[model samples]
Target chain A: MTMARRLRTKDLSAGYDSRVILKDISLEVPAGRITAIVGGNASGKSTLLRTLARILKPKGGSVLLDDNVIHDMPSNAVARIMGLLPQSPIAPEGITVADLVGRGRHPHHGLFSRWNAADDRAVTDALTATGIAGLAERDLDTLSGGQRQRAWIAMALAQQTDLLLLDEPTTFLDVAHQIDVLDLLVDMNLSRRTTVVMVLHDLNLAVRYADHLIAVAQGGIHCQGTPADVLTEATVKTVFGLDCRIVTDPVSGTSTMVPIGRHKSGSVGQEAQSRK
Target chain B: MTLIIDTQAAAPASHARNRGTRRAVIVLNMLGLCLVGLIALTLSCGQGCLPPAHVLAALTGADAGGADFVVNDLRLPRALMSLVVGLCFGLGGAAFQVMLRNPLASPDIIGISAGAGAAAVFAIVVLSLEGWAVSAVAVSAGLGIATLIWGLSSGRGAAGARLILVGIGVSAMLNSVTSYLLLDAPAWDRAEAMRWLTGSMNGAQLVQVWPVVAALAVFGGLLAVSARDLDLLRLGDDAARALGVRSDATRFRVTLAAVGLVAFATSAAGPVAFVAFLSGPIAARLTRGGRFILPAAGLIGAILVLAGDYAGQFMLPARLPVGVVTGAIGAPFLLLLIVKANRNGGTL
Candidate 1:
């Protein structure tokens, strides 16, 4: 399934109030492929995601979604076509998982419209897709970290939008859960062809999971392309200030970075395996 | 991913079951029954030892002139005022809590009632006004307090704490203004202003009570129309917006409804302190409902004011104002809330 639509920005500048956080940054997120935006702590990765999500309006950039400027698009319309999972989005206390996922259907369900079979089907499908069908009745707070994140994703999925954006979805999870969530995203991309854009801290995971890469640094796009093309040693050093050995992951056949630290022996190359 | 495979507890139809509503209905019915008893007691025992039988007889249009006059003309209106005002305060406050997603968002404590009282006081002492014009003053004052609180709390998306704090500030300012007006004015108007300052149900007649009843109808309808949206609002803004609810607009309407509800009740009976605040929490606690239960909370509010009024004047040698009774009962409850909120880090 080749769903190759594209979201592009032309000279977009945005920030909080008057402070310019993202400079005249321009990039394209090709649909039907995961775009991992990589940068250090203040590289404006999250801001770019929010701007693309239309939660924060850009000052001067034009975000064109299939020729319709997303800035000019009604937020609900944008929200309907594209879903966003903001980092650390707080759920209302005591709301159940099914209720949380049910919220994703809100964009589809107009006021005064009765809940129908399709809504139920979509909610069930989202839960099943994320493998939370059994825990669908559980309170959101009771779920473990990874399970909760998947629930949040299931909420985004239940929107049934063609596009999905996630910010640091793996921030608090353990490595095993991180793999579980990334695996789900990969499966979602393959099966549904949902355009996925995310800010990922793990460099190797970004390369492994994302088909396209966007490296943001100093309020601008530093590099963007296929993961292997963008995840060069020079880009890594400039963006993350880490000397690393780049290798193709034997299993996934993607660019994987082994970060080089000073703790290794003088002759020993920096093959810092984070978690095997 | 500790999926644990628990099909029993997923977040779907299990939440939509009728338990919350059932609890609310039971509590409201009991409260309603007690209110009926309190009203009967109020009509029967006040300065006249008229038997419950006589009041019931007069209420049924039997021909006893003295009993008819007291039951139909005097105490009935007072009791009805307590009922209506309490409903206004309770339901209105509950609606506010659901709207703002905060327990501290009640009309009585958050300066809306203070705004009405302040405006009414200004109309009386500063402008030397009288009669139904105070209702208009009340509407505007309550609206003003709401806007000020909204303006102050805009940064935090009008979090409960911010609204409560800003409301307290405005209420304090208005209260001081009221005190100044009362203290500086002539002795002739002094006694009259005092009743307006403290919430009162004394000297209330049906004609005077109509404004509150009417206000409750309009405001209460507005809230009911928006009740489902208000219920979704307690789920946080993103979740609410995701649910296709135009949240900010809905919030505005809810605020307007709350202001109208409290302002009219204040105009009719004077800021019957904390009934609005207490009723919502009590209802939520008792019913364990998912979101705002406005009518249920309102029933509790009506019961509190009516029962408090009954216990106050008749239970004592001297007649205590309805507001005094409510304060005496509601203060300790407020203290308990403060302690609970403090222990829970004050978010409730």
Candidate 2:
């Protein structure tokens, strides 16, 4: 796999209609590594990812691909190098998994081109990589949530881009499924040297899975670095507006954030006295 | 899993895709055959009930006595008009439904047909226009109304529902305009306008058939070019864009071509009631929701118009207009679909 592709944003501003959600945010994604953007609800993490993916047009500045303005390039040319899986994508009623995944080859063909052997191989490989090859003939509506998400990921995989961006991929899944998805992403990153960037709601999972972490706050990036450097208590307090303690994760040997709420104080004496 | 298991699992996926492709091909061929049979039956069995040989002789420009005038001048033009007009409605309607991701968003339901109807009525009654001039006015008005509806409903999110609702409102308004025009016209002009408004194959000239045929060629060609891109749009704007489809451009091209098709057909055929609304869903059902439904839908549209015209003229107690018969069939289906959607919590 080519490791020359680089995705970066320079002083970018973007939003819906008139309301700017991300303002002058600048960041570079490390190629062939897993990067995670984490934040509280509506903190522009998704907006930033969408802007980079060119799903949302940047209001000012630019998202650059190998130092070229992404928006200025032909959309199909950019799509050939990068793929994005949105937060919620609709499946047409009664579409089979293989058929849906094959749609990922959209950028590879022109208006009059027929599906070739390469297209078939890409779809097969994607389905196999996502471990949903067995469910290829099944209707998407019949799949479990995890399996459905896997199908969607398989679609992005079929695109065969060097860069993959995902927005809240594990939002509706169980914890086991969340880990399953993250592990799959890591596998892709390691095996294919495919750059993976995702917006994660779970801070600990983001810290655990991502090699680099970016914290977003109030329409701009608050902090960014290695997980250990960026997931400190001060960054969490500022970015999420929540009091939290950062500790070493025993499982992953990475930083983990444990939020401290009004009632769940870890004082043993206070808990005992309240019980008495 | 080993390579053996992987190949085994992969087999069914390819098999399913092949099966779907095969099914679509078979269904389209069947629809084409049915359309041909209907056209043949229509030609051979009207009024005096000429034989196939006589009809064929007339069609081939060999003298078949009095059969020449009836077959060449009358039934052939009407059947040809139905064929082209049906193709236009089916293709245009399915394009709208698929692009909007709603089965109910056909041109007739969305005021495009009403626009053409209102214009034709205005031309016949007020402007005193005749022949091709009336068709030209109707086509222009249909295109104008489509543009207006698209502009009104387009925005950031949930544009499909907004477009459908806006179209319904516009349709109602245009229908009222058509009615009001009819109410004040002279008796002879009123009768002529009413026949046009209700959509009839009566006086379907060979000249009128050519414009719709030309429309089917140009606009249908445009639609064919964008067919794959339009199918991708079914996955929603974000996904389509990520897949490298220029969603806005595809939508624009599709909308323009589809409107051109509906407008031209309406101008020639006078807004054949519900033919546009009914074709897509019927074709979808017949094809079992295949990936490419436009061609099947177009064939179905042709069949419906041809069959409805034949049935209305012959089978009905009174010789009714084609629109009335199709309207009767379509209105009940629309109600059933709405009811089913409502029961499913407002999804179709």
Candidate 3:
């Protein structure tokens, strides 16, 4: 396995033209671990991830990979060490799962080089690891939502990078499939020692699966630590701006935030308050 | 768990890829055969109607007497012009369509051809310019118009849709300028200017073929080098960038190459109507959106112009320009596409 590459942002400010979404922020992604960025809508979660992936140019400051400025480094060289799966990537019409995954070898080959055995091996390994080898010949348009997401993940896996970044990898899936994808990501992190960083919408899943959590709010990092340290009643209120009770998840033995809404059963709320 | 690096495990994926490659190869070979047959037929069946044998003998520099002048001087240039101009249009058109991720965003559909055509007409009718000067003006105007459309349509939401819409508007305005120039010109000049407007192969010369061929060599080579990066851009900007494609750089190279092709071809053959617009979708259908889209589209473009020019010259009641025949075919297809897009509520 390749050594896990260091990815960190030093006072990074990034956004679209003339609009700064993420203010001056400093953070480091732990190597060989899973880090999840969780935030409310338009809270700069994606901006942070994009800047880290070097998709969006930073307005100020820099993202450093292995002590070298990432944006200034040659893109292909950076891509050989790091891979990313953006939210809602468009698959060309009628593309097969294998062909899409094979495209991940782009960074490995020069302009005139042919696909070699190592590329085939990486693609094969990625397919097997993601459990999509059987669907290699299947058109992406024919796959189920969960299967399509897996195929996309398989593409990133085929890149053979030490660090992988994903933006909301489980956005539109059902609860079961969401867990399934998260489990697959965890499996990758464990088996390959690939540093995994992702933006996730589900707070409970982020707390359960991620080794480290970064809660973003109002364009900057509100808190960063292990899940146990980051998930709290006050943190939920501050980050998501919702009244919620932090409860111990029985299945995962992690902190789960259950939002307290006006229409909730009064008896249940009172029982939760009493327990607290 | 032990890692499985078995070569056998990759068989199914490689097999699928090989199948796609095989399909593309077979289709391209068939298109090549058709192009050969059309070129032969074109050389043989005009005016005095020489036999294939006589045409072949003339082509091979044998003494076929009168057939030599007819084949070598008359039909050869026209045939060669059709081939190169068609290729330029087809390759340029597909490049734009793929880059924009919209089938409706071809150079002719969007304003590049009109930009070139309008400039050529102005040079010929108003300035009384001839030859290279007209072509030079046309090429510069095409590039300028493409840049203008690109700049205007970029910013917030749905840049592809906005660009196509803006291009259509610009094309209309430029076309009207061409018509106005034609209307005010002297009668003799009007006929000459009409070739630029409707795209004629009427007076094609051997000298005219070389410039477009040279343009094809340079610009086509550029497109070929940038082909894979252009393919990745189909996945959208962010995803392509993540895959290490410098999206902006790739887009610039592709745009320059494609615009160069359109302008050069337009200068030579007057845009050739819908050859550029029609080639990509046809080739995509034939190749099933395979890896050889660019080359296959160029072949299809060549075939369209050759076949259309033949039909216009012989099969039709009146001797129409190649563009007229293709325009007749393309306009209805355009309507059908619009109807289909509307029915599906797709962003065409």
Candidate 4:
């Protein structure tokens, strides 16, 4: 792809039939950069992504891709420019990795065009991109969680879109796998300048990897900016409703958040000894 | 990057593998066709008393003495009915299985076939209707029942399991009504009602084949056109939509086509028990892959009906209806599936 396209929401309001989950949300996604959306449970982070991807119809307002209303564009046309990886997508029984990834080429072909060399190359490139080329013949059910996640990312990558939206892509993975996924996204951004938007729960990782961070709370954007500007202690308190200390990570030179709870005022052992 | 080079290098191997999978699918389909042909030949051989050479001669349009009427007139329509009805049921069943993402969600299990049966039996035993009137009512009733199930299951993105559970409950209730109508039926009408109840190919007319042919053409064409989207639906609604498959529209079209297929078949063949339920899993097992084998399943269904009728005619001491034999065979498989699904804890 050439220069990544811009995705923006204009006064967007959406929800499940008659109940609004996101309200009056207006934002512009920076082209060709990594952005992470962080929020508490049911904070409409995923819903926002779904609406922007045109999976859910917005009750009011619209999402735009390069000034065209995304909802108004043909779905396949939108798909050519943007791709989404949802939370916990199902794999059909007995599907091979190659077959599963090949489905991602669906939007590229016309109704009667058979799968040709180009489609095969795209699928293979996806498998190679995700480092699962050797496992192409393996069944999806047989892969480990991290490997499965990588395979799904490969499927999205096969679309070869300029923009990608992922919802909690690292939810079930171990710590190392989480970092592996983030690192892979960063690599894609650097190599292809693909615009990346993701919903993540790991605050420190978000700070380390995201060029822009969006904090959502109460059906609106609570904060949006670079991590250093958006991860301040006051903003964290407003967004998460938790008291927390913000410090710089010595290794990555990025902001890290340490939350304080009601029970622990100091070191636990010291507090117990003083009470005794 | 090296990823591009590695992908290019591995392309030929993966290309060969793709060809291999396609070959397996084609071979399985060819095998199904051969089985259907074999069963058709067996069905036309006339009580096993006629020699195969005589039957072959008759089939080749040569004069075969007295066996002409038995082979061409009586056996041909019934056997052709089995094939057509089987295709409808099999295609509809596999479509349901793929779209609903559940193996057990066949039209028969989900009450669409029963809806047609109930209406047809009611027309026969109570309203005193027959032929095309009965078929029309049956089709409408089947669509009505599918609509009802669709309504009940449409509760804010309820999953496939919910629709199936509701369908099982609804089918059980409709079956009771059918049984009651059979009991209260006049003695003369009881036999016809009973045939519809168990589902049979007995006395099927050559004229009756056209509706099913028409339905299969229209709906089968629709299915072929939407096969790619239907396959993408296996990834679930969100992912399918993300892939630009109009998920809701594709699902609606597939469901409509599937319901139309089974309804037309049921009106013609009296709901031929379990052909729809068995063909999808059987085809999947035969093909041994994840791709939807609509045509293969249709062929398997034809084989099942033809073979079932043959077994009913010759295997037992007293002749039985095709429906009875299929039911007898299918109930055991259904039981096996239930036991397996129970063991697997809700995968079915």
Candidate 5:
């Protein structure tokens, strides 16, 4: 049987208890493309990501994974087709990197199935892919922030799903580490044709990395399309309330945003050009 | 860069060695401690007058004289009861610790055992009951208390910390009731009440051992099967769900099995101090990895009870009961863990 690669949400309304964070949101993640959801804080981007990942129950409408209603499907069946990494993934104390990664293979085995060589190889390959093979035996708590994030990504990768969702995967990293994480995600997309949906706080990074940009505002999609079309200066002002100049990145030829503050409207673009 | 490359090359080799050695150490410790505990039980059996050799002979049914009567009628039943009670406490405690993600969340501390204690005390002091009747009441009370705690803490997103808080409050209230009953009891009932209050394994009959064995076979098997789900739970709710774990259902079933195990254990042996509280952390420490180690904790719990009973019998000059000895040792450790947990701001 052929598996469906498309993930779409239909007018989904969800929240914690009575407070609805995401309202009447409809979105379809382009198959085999990197989709980045960007918005201000409390703009429902994370909630939308979580709802799409099936971690949060939608009060209205449904998330359709390849045409099947996700809420009706068994979670293990959904898990086999998709994976999610939360904003901050926690590792139980003293868990080795390899052991943590191996847990990702949960959907493949039943209650009594022994851990076979295929599971072992998948874990090893995930560790190697995330460049944490050397840290396989190291305790998770002992790793640096970037390495730890990679380990978590490795776990998601070991799921070997067609679609992967991440909420702020690079929130706590340094600039270099942020680029490293984005590059890894790009590599995963390019090499494996994995549909990646992520919420990113950095507008420029989102434009640079995402094949499709979803600008969220007021608990709804403000703009959605290719970065060049969706992330214009006016949309940035409307979505983030930040007046900004849009320019093409010298290296990636993607749209980049430069914020024009109250006093430095004309100098921002010059500064960015000089830095390049 | 050079150092990074070199260390990376050598890490997996040392890591493999480290894992192998740690595993070997855990196995050796479990086996060795069990042997020591069994030997201690045998030695403590002959404390009245007979020698250790005579106790051993009696145990084997070789010396079917006075030694046989003491060993079979008194020592053997007590020892077997201790073992079974310890297993139940260990498995139940380990399950709570893993499920709640806190070492301090044992059935003893969380009032499940206290419910059993309160009921048993009520039966013995107020109703003038003894033996199986008290045991039956204790078991039912334990289940009731667990249900109460679950009901109280089953709010939206009622995670480990909230459950622990509710449990602690319920336990404290139940403890007060138990104390009041003990104080109001007649002088004749005070001795039995005191033994029960402090968790004694004295005068353990063959009948007490059977119910616990049966409980362990049922509840212990359930807990063992659900062990993986408990491990998944430690990764927090969202991650567990993402990995296809039905968190709510798994939590419910595991809690029921664990509560049953603790209730049976408490009815069989008294609350028995902190065997449930201490076993999981002790097993985790001994194993030295992040594995849950439920079976290892169970073995450790069994060994601790047997050893604690033996220590109470022979180590102290006054010959205190098993519960008193365990309480004395475990209370300080509990305090230490509380302080450590607060300092780390990890889990309660």
Candidate 6:
């Protein structure tokens, strides 16, 4: 893929009132790849994502896309090219699945612009891409956690942006649903070559899916590399302070984890081994 | 009970409901006609009954024999004022409600009306603005108060909920200040201030109609131009900005428009109580979730105040103030809304 400066942040410092959360952070979100951001809890992972998306302003430095300052552009202009789905998106009461998906076309529209064939095509493509095309007419509030996540993803997809940023896309879902959402992401990556940046709590999933890993720690990046190299047992211990044995997954040959918490380490591993 | 999860209930709800805009237009036109009917009823229904034909004749200067002098002058001004007041109140109220995305965010309940009223009251009592100048200053004050609220609420993006809360607070302070001024005035001036404060169409004239009409005409057009932006605003600042909306600029422009609208309404009608709060909800309910209820709200507000004015003036021959009747009707609606909000689990 031909790579250019899609989004770059330089010496960026941002925070809420009175205290700075991130300082002197410089980073690049590579175009045409899935860049998984793996960090321990409270490492300003979400803050970094929000600043890149221009939802929060940096006190210092600049976030640039194609050499244009992000803060300078009208939000719709930027939104027409980039989509961000924050963790726990709120839905308007009684918003139908179609309506929620349709709102994703907001940036592409102007005042007095009616819903046209293009908007409909975008929404239809998004819902189908997210594998929720069958349920396009359903109310969003009534969808399951997994299905609702897809709906939200569909909304982002309708943006038709080259870059998609998701903040912990699999936060509250069950293990099965987490895999479902990840599979959808894989489909998107394979089909569209859409540049994806996301913060993931699950290090194993991060290792499994990411083409590149950006690991943030203590207000700045601790390391950035391919996940196989950076997600060793020692790195895991240092970042999250949990003991885990890393092994290749028998199915996909990606890294899999054998977590060791105090309560049930030995017997659980044996029971798992017998089952396998 | 089974929660039906049909993905194919009516694919692309808007496509199925292709009659959406048409239905809304038809309903709105019907509502407009209803408001006109209410105005006619208001004009000629009380103390002396005049034929509807004669009432129309009196209105257009077509009455040859001049059999409806009562309808032509006194009742006509009252009806006109109600129509104008209702339109302004509805537009302003509905604008605030949808813009804030909170039903509690109406101009009256959130203190937009009080802010305008206080400024107008100050102009009348303290600044001693009289005749055309009195209402003009009042309008300016109303705009000034709205500007102050919007300014106070300004942040990096769209006006946050905190800023709106601050506006509510500012409105409270202004209301108290207005009360104090009214209390300290000379008895004669106190009576005059009280009438305006409570709101009345009793002394309103045809001349007063032009200012209100003109204010609505100018400010209402600005609001129409900014309507789509306001619709996007209900999605919250972060969501809006992330979607490539210039949240700050949009908020600033919409706010300026809202202030202009609110100020003009207050100047013309002395804050007219709950029309601003009620009109938007009524219009939204009738429209079933269309964004920015300006035209429909204006019609509903016109009907409400006109009907309320008529009721106040001659419903019982008791000669109650229009404000009193609106308060009587509006207070119950407010309580019902609160109960509904509570039942629905939280804020809209």
> Best candidate, TM-score-wise?
3
- All models: lDDT? 0.79, 0.87, 0.88, 0.83, 0.82, 0.75
The TM-score-based order of candidates, best leading, equals 3, 2, 4, 5, 6, 1
Q: Against the hidden true structure, what lDDT does model 2 obtain? A: 0.87
Tens-digit lDDT track for model 1 on A166-226?
Answer: 9998999999999999999999999999999999999889988888999988788888998
i-RMSD of model 4 (Å, 1 decimal): 2.3
Q: Compared with the true structure, what per-residue lDDT tens digits does model 1 show for residues B1-348?
A: 346544433434344323333555677788778777777778888765887778778989997657998888888898999999999999888888767666776777778888898788788767877667888888988887788888887754567566778877888888787777777777635335645676877778889788888888899998887887777666566555544456778888888888898888888888887888888888776665444467778888988898887776688776777787788777898888778776763332
Q: Give the CAPRI rating of model 5.
A: acceptable
What TM-score does each of the candidates earn?
0.85, 0.95, 0.96, 0.93, 0.91, 0.87
> Which DockQ value does candidate 3 get?
0.65
- Model 5 reaches what TM-score against the true structure? 0.91
List where candidate 6 sits over 4 angstroms from the true fold.
Answer: A1-5, A266-276, B1-23, B67-72, B143-173, B187-194, B292-294, B340-345
Question: Model 4, range A226-265, lDDT digits (tens) per residue?
Answer: 9999998888778887767888898899889887665665
**Top model number, DockQ:** 3
Candidate 5 ranges beyond 4 A from true positions: A1-4, A263-276, B1-25, B28-40, B43-45, B48-63, B123-140, B150-154, B157-162
Q: Per-residue alpha-carbon lDDT of model 4 for B1-348, expressed as tens digits? A: 999976666774266457647866786768666876755576456565676666667767898887777776778778888888988999999898888877778899989988988887788778998677877788789889988998998854344677888899888888887888888876845446656677777777789888788888998899888888988887988999999999888987888788888888888887788999999888777665456467778888888888888878778897877888888889999888878766763332
| Residue B48, candidate 3: C-alpha displacement in angstroms | 4.7
User: What is the DockQ score, from 0 to 1, of model 4?
Assistant: 0.58
Poorest stretch of ten by lDDT in candidate 2 chain B = B339-348
Model 2 Cα lDDT, one tens digit per residue, B1-348: 599976775575566678778888999999999999999988888986998889999999898878999888889999999999999999999998888878778899989889988898898789999777877788789889978887798764244567888999999999899888888885755335646676778888898888788889989999999998888888878889999999989988898888889888887777889988888888777776677689999999999999999999999898888898999999999898778656652321
lDDT for each residue of candidate 6 in B1-348, tens digit (9 for 90 to 100): 133433442245345234445657886999978987887677667776777787777777885356456876777777888887778788877777776666667777767778777877777778877556766676566667666666677744333456557777987787788888888676545436655566777677888788778877887787887776666555566566667767667666666666666666676667777777788777777765544267888888888888777777767567776777888788898888868866763233
Clashes of each: 9, 0, 0, 0, 0, 5
Write out the backbone clash pairs for model 3: none
Task: List, for all models, the DockQ compared with the true complex.
Answer: 0.29, 0.62, 0.65, 0.58, 0.46, 0.39
Off by over 4 Å in 3: A267-276, B1-8, B156-158, B187-191, B344-348
